[model samples]
Target chain A: NAGVTQTPKFRVLKTGQSMTLLCAQDMNHEYMYWYRQDPGMGLRLIHYSVGEGTTAKGEVPDGYNVSRLKKQNFLLGLESAAPSQTSVYFCASSYLTPSGGRQVEQFFGPGTRLTVL
Target chain B: GIQVEQSPPDLILQEGANSTLRCNFSDSVNNLQWFHQNPWGQLINLFYIPSGTKQNGRLSATTVATERYSLLYISSSQTTDSGVYFCAVGDYNQGGKLIFGQGTELSVKP
Candidate 1:
């Protein structure tokens, strides 16, 4: 299994440009998340999905959107890129119970280095 | 909202040395994890310790849920152990949302 794979390992975008980051997990996980890591800062959640058709905003959900149409794929979209959005983006997935009781370990993908100019 | 804090933002040690990294959370957590992010930015899961202690090779972790803190120990450090160590906590009541600490950067020199 690839665990988690992210496309476009690296990218540079001009200001106001838009793009979507694709995250795929072969672990058959039920939970997926998008997070951004800035220099000297902790990873902040951008968005997450509990299941195939459910999505929710996280700590730093502003300036970003997400969609989880399939159980294995989670996509993060930037409507208009900004310099502040430039950071290493990581995609993670886990298996959790439907009632939100037990927590599972998260498997993270090799991050994508994004530069917004 | 939950707060996660890691101590010794930067640590420098020589080969074969041992060190401890700490994480303190603001509230009770259902899941506490330790992750190592290599220089290439790939995060590797080290442990999922919410309570008690667990050891793997030269690395071990302990989480005291009542005190809302966790510790990760690295023994006989190697260059491969050099990277940023992050402590993340998941709130079960909040639908398994993970909050991370700023991470402790460790530099092991041979």
Candidate 2:
């Protein structure tokens, strides 16, 4: 399985610019998430989707929006980028059903490095 | 919001040495996972141990859910183990919303 994959491994954008990050998973996971990683901040969830056609705000969802139109795809959108949004973005997916364990482990992507000027 | 904290923000060890990393959470959690972010920036899930102990190769993890903490042990480490190790927790009340810790940076020298 390809697991989880993210597009635009690296990007550079100026203030007020807009961009969308694409995440796709072949594992047929029921849950998908978007997270941002910054130095000394770990990985903070930006948004998540429980399933297709469903999305919810996460801990840090102010400047970001998400859409999950299909079961295999999740998109993160930054309408107006800001310098503070310059961080490594990660996409993760997990299955809700128990698989040998009660806790579901999330599989992460390679991460997208975004730099805002 | 539940808070997660990892100890020993930085670690340096010889390739053959052993090390222990810790993660402490502010509240009770029903799920906890350990991950290794390689130099290439790939977050690889190491263990999904919310409680009890589990061993994989030269690595092992133990989580005491009642105490709200977890430990990861690396034995006979190798240069390939150089990376950041993070622990994330999800409260049972929450719908599997995992919160991450700052992570412990490990540098194994050959």
Maximum-DockQ candidate: 1
For residues A14-117, what per-residue lDDT tens digits would candidate 1 score against the true structure? 99999999999998898899999999887988899988999998989999989999999999999999999999999999987667566588889998999999
Q: Candidate 1 lDDT, tens digit per residue, B2-108? A: 89999999999999999999999999888888999889888999999989999999999999999999999999999999999999998755657789999999999
lDDT of 2 at B80: 98
Best of the candidates, lDDT? 1
Model 2 CAPRI quality: medium
Please state the error at residue B24 of candidate 1 in Å: 0.8
In the order shown, the candidates' Cα RMSDs to the true structure are 1.4, 1.8
Which ranges of candidate 2 are over 4 A from the true structure? Answer: A98-103
